[model samples]
Target: MAIRNMTVATRSLDADMTVDEFKEWLRRFDTDRDGRISREELRRAMRAIRARFTGWRSRQGISYADADGDGYIDDSEVDGLIEFAQKNLGLKIVAY
Candidate 1:
């Protein structure tokens, strides 16, 4: 397996303080004020990153990484997917 050279913020669900922190970040992603993140939101975010980061990766063969298989990336999904949006989208991640 190739080593992914990326600085993704992923926190273990088992660890303290991280799980909650991630949940908060995820909330920002969901702009509809919906309790869960819908696939549309994920797709939009995915596309936005691609537009800014030329050569950015798309949601090509990955499913679970984006969110729950049902289409929503809920609080429960946060624990496992610690990958950076840039890595997942194959784009340059910007913090600002």
Candidate 2:
């Protein structure tokens, strides 16, 4: 996927991303296709949004969203990640 054009495709994800849309976008970074998001994947996602301090933020995001202490954000923990993205990454997400 072209990371540079992702923002344009999603309108920078500032307009508002539905829960499904957010998950779809995030999944693009799951390089391993493990149906889970790791710190590195999260960092890449952060970079896609042009966020600063990606390393730190990715660590923090994993810490915040890894509810099961699995070191990865799985499906059930996605809500926490969504919250982290909205609050810390300045992304607007809407549940509809």
Candidate 3:
């Protein structure tokens, strides 16, 4: 998946959603509207996209993956995350 000439791995989504984009996406996943995205919440949202992604959320430690701990990912890790979200999580927008 290459965006803007950046040869990156492929993921499924309308486009490569960044961690920050994912943060907002997380909000959609949190159907309960709980402000914070739990594993279960992530699972629910991911279920529509892919069942595999749920575990990655837990495996990668969502709480810690945020890096600065600002409750979001805004850097390189987005690539890995995109893979997890697409392959494991099951996103339906961008096709990798």
Candidate 4:
């Protein structure tokens, strides 16, 4: 996927965004392009969203999402991250 210049602070996630769109947006912070989100990448994402305590939040996110204990949010565990984003980060993501 082509990485856009849009940052979460500049182009906030829309409440109506579909799950795929949300994933695409989140991927922007996947700096290594490893097809997985790391704790540091998630910290950057949280920072872009103006979230406080980004380090703590990122750790919590990874803890919640990394169901395989692999230390990364891979495709299979993305849903858990999405739930964390919604409940903790106040992001609105839809399944449709």
Candidate 5:
């Protein structure tokens, strides 16, 4: 799936949630509510999104978005994760 544009992809999200809403959607994956999603948390979230990822979270999915190399996804890295999802998994983030 080719993500041609952010606007189109944003609209493709469930209920056409805005970018901020998409961020909030991802926030739910932060099980600890510490404003960050750990590697494991991200893996489970991807599964919830119906993404078919293989291997462990630390090795595959996390590496794509963990820009800071901190082993966790902070607010700054959320966009990276979004982009990864769009480009690789074709996931449309939505506020639920």
Candidate 6:
């Protein structure tokens, strides 16, 4: 039997905060006040928050959160981002 090493991918949030807190964090990036985060906006936000977003990573993030396939992340899609942060990224986020 051959053993294989599996590397788990994970990202860490800088702090433990609530869903509302997460929303607030997103708001910082939603500059247009359209209640949606554009890919560019998300990129800026990622830079401000973690300072770690390449073009490809930004697009990937947008695609992950943009559940509607609308090319942007609306308020409805925010929860998905929150979930990703909390689950896949190992961030601690409190529920409302």
Candidate 3, run of 10 with poorest lDDT:
2-11
Cα lDDT of candidate 2 equals 0.84
TM-score, every prediction: 0.43, 0.87, 0.42, 0.86, 0.68, 0.72
Model 1, residue 44: distance off in Å is 2.0
Q: For residues 6-96, what per-residue lDDT tens digits would candidate 5 score against the true structure?
A: 4321334333444576676677678898988887777766666555553464356578888979888788887787777667766565434
lDDT of 1 by residue, 1-96 (tens): 111322223322222333334445556668898776665655554444333432232233125454546656666664334454434533222222
- Candidate 1 clashes: the total is 3
Clashes per model (N, Cα, C within 3 A) = 3, 0, 10, 0, 0, 0
Error of 4 at 45 (Å): 0.7
- Model 4 lDDT, full chain set: 0.84
Give the per-residue Cα lDDT of candidate 5 at 96: 40
Greater TM-score among 1 and 6 belongs to 6
lDDT for each of the candidates? 0.44, 0.84, 0.50, 0.84, 0.65, 0.66
lDDT of 4 by residue, 1-96 (tens): 322455567656444556887788789899999999999999998888788999999999999999999899999999999999989988777766
Better of 2 and 5 by lDDT: 2
- Evaluated at residue 48, the lDDT of candidate 2 is 76
Candidate 3 accuracy as lDDT: 0.50
After superposition, the stretches of candidate 4 with alpha carbons farther than 4 Å from their true spots are: 1-7
| Residue-by-residue lDDT tens digits, candidate 3, 1-96 | 323332223324454545545545556656566465555655565555554545666546455444455554444344444555566444532533
Model 5 residue runs over 4 Å out of place are 1-16, 54-58, 93-96
Q: What TM-score should be assigned to candidate 4?
A: 0.86
